[model samples]
Target: MHKPRILVVDDEPQIHRFLGPALNAAGYEPVRADSGREALAEIARKPPEAVVLDLGLPDLDGQEVLKRARDFYEGPVVILSARDREIEKIEALDAGADDYVEKPFRVGELLARLRVVMRRQQRQQEEPPPVVHAGDLVIDLPRRLVTRAGEALRLSPKEYDLLAKLAEADGKVLTHKELLVSIWGPAHAHDMQYLRVFIGQLRQKIEADPAAPKLILTQPGIGYRFMADEALRPSGA
Candidate 1:
């Protein structure tokens, strides 16, 4: 089997230095691009299985890089940036990134996220089951429908997609970018505001208490998780 190819786009040499060995050790072929222009060139020449993009590219804004990347690359694009502001993170995710890593991140965590992306991609290539469930919420993939507590719940196209994706992972946490790409297409992956609004709407329709949700749970400053019904047991029995 061919090793998974990864394109690492960043203006900083340090990032390449830090990530190259890690990726190589993890059995992936790493291709480096020092600027957004170079990144585009690399992508046009040959698209990789995944892209690790930096938001602080010299030639163009990382978000613009993301936009251009979508024209050619269909795989996951994870943003690696120094920006820690919530708004900036939200913007990048909405712009099309599949995940975000703040600067000074742990290599182990980054690799783990990469693995998650790879696994999700692989799952997409295989035959998928018709229905997905989490607690009282059940999604019928063939019918494009959702039901909670034995009652049908109307969900918008995007909302349904989001819920289905989350249900597929069960108790796993999904970053904003991951949800955006899975549901809204790569071009809108960085549009976190849109996700927030839709999630709120979804909660109103599905959750018993949107304020203190029981199913769709938030991981502040990280992402969201769809808690498995079995995992919500009372503390200490």
Candidate 2:
């Protein structure tokens, strides 16, 4: 069987020098691209199972590369960069990165992250159970429909995506960055206003009282949580 291919886009030779052997040992076939332009070209030439992208590229910036790659690529793209700032990580994630790893990352940790990404991707591809009921609203995942008290509720594409993401988490808190990246893609990760507007729109339709939402609860500075009912929550009350 062909080893899973990982496109490593970085300008640094040392990264390639070490990553090649390390990835090889980890059962991945590593391909190198020194610049964003080259990375794009390489991706087009041979589609990779996943991408390990660096933010600062000689020819094109990493975020741009990620956006462009997303136009045609559907696989995971993990941002491997030195930029450790929260905003930078948010930007990269919103730009289409599946995961972010700081430059001084441990090989074991990186490998484990890749595994997680792959597993999540696989799970997303697999179909889940048909419906979810949280409070008074019912969501049909396969049909992409939502209803409240037997009346169908209309929702925008983004709103549905956001709600579905939260519902799947089963009462877990999802960070602002995590929700934004997962729903709107990485580019809008920092656009809290967008989230606020959409979340409000969603509440108007799903919540019995938008003024005092019970399904979607704010976690103050951290993020938001889907207040699933005891029966709906994975813990099964």
Candidate 3:
């Protein structure tokens, strides 16, 4: 069995020393990159299952590395940085980092986070289930039908499309720009108003109480995520 590869990008020798053994013990093949340039090169050469990146690098900012990597790399990136400010966290997350961990962190916590992201990635790669169940709602992907409490709910074309997109994400946060670009095309990439309006309409139709939605949770300044518990069936089931 081949262990999943993990790329560690940090300039500190001590970090490499610390994480190398921990990752190996956790069943991951740890690959090291001491600089942003090397990190990018390694990623292009062969992308890892996930990347543990540090924001403070000798040549390039870790955030910049994340932005550039997002151009082509779709793997999970967890920022292991010393920057603990709320703004820094938001910036890194919005820049495409999956999760953030401040420095002086526990190895156990990092391993848990890695497991969550890798599992999420695996789910995303699998063929979407034919039907998804969330609370009292049921989404029939093959029929594009949605029902609440066994009653069919009418949704506009765009609204259904948006809902389908969120459901297909498998609980991942879909950034506002990502949603816009994917749903409305590049010309509407900056149309935040359109997204808000549609989201509101979707909630009204789907949520038992649209005012305080539970199914579609907002990520505030980042994007939206589907938080309702989902029951997914196997592809061939």
Candidate 4:
């Protein structure tokens, strides 16, 4: 039986030294790429189930790798970076990575994150989600269609994806990290600005008053949640 494959894109020899055995011991096949261009070529040639990417690539920047990877690779991309700046994390997540791992991370922690992502991916494939409804809003997830007040609404791909994820977990507060990583990818999870921009756009289209949004409630310092009832928005929501 073939073990699940993982592509590790990092310039550091120590990263490979550390992760190679960890991945192998965890029952995964580890592949290595030392630069962004090499990572891209490897992905195109034989896609791995997941990607471990370092943001500072010598040839191509990590963000460019993610931008190009999004074209053909839909799998999870966990970013590895020593730069702990929030903006950096936001940029990577928005670019299309699945998770972000700060440098000097514990091997156990990295493995745990890998398992979480793999499990989420597997569960998603195993179950078919139900159509979503929130008063005037209607979302047919599988068809990638949405309508509000009995009228179809035009939305960009990213907008629709964000809405769908919100609708999928109706009434649940989706953290900024969760929504960003799930919709935009891990690299972008910290980019709350992108979330704000998209959420504002969504409210304008779906709410009777964009100024006073009811369907999509802001959790304040948390994330956003989709209220199933248009009229039952939480107090001060």
lDDT of each: 0.77, 0.78, 0.83, 0.79
1 or 2, which is superior by TM-score? Answer: 1
Winning candidate number (TM-score): 3
Candidate 3, which segments miss by more than 4 Å at Cα?
A: 12-26, 44-46, 67-74, 79-113, 208-212, 228-237
lDDT of 4 by residue, 88-176 (tens): 66667657665666787878777766775665466567774466777778888988989987788999999999898887653444668
For candidate 1, lDDT tens digit of each residue in 118-169? 6656666786557766668877888888888889997777788878777776
Clashing pairs in 4: 92-187, 92-188, 93-187, 93-188, 94-188, 97-185, 97-186, 98-186
Ranking by lDDT: 3, 4, 2, 1
TM-score of each: 0.66, 0.60, 0.71, 0.59
Clashing residue pairs in candidate 2, if any?
93-186, 94-186, 94-187, 95-186, 95-187
RMSD of each: 6.7, 8.2, 5.7, 9.8
Question: Per-residue lDDT for 97-190 in model 2, tens only?
Answer: 7666777777776676676566556656886446778766888888899999888988889899999988776444467888887888889878
Candidate 1 positional error at 70, Å: 0.6
The candidate, 2 or 4, that scores higher on TM-score is: 2
Kindly report which residue stretches of model 1 are placed more than 4 angstroms away from their true locations once superposed. Answer: 133-140, 143-162, 168-215, 219-237
For model 2, give the 10-residue run with minimal summed lDDT: 228-237
Worst 10 contiguous positions by lDDT, candidate 3: 228-237
- Residue 53 lDDT (model 2): 91
Worst 10 residues of 1 by lDDT: 228-237
Cα distance off (Å), candidate 1, residue 208: 13
**What are the runs in model 2 whose C-alpha is more than 4 Å off?**
129-237
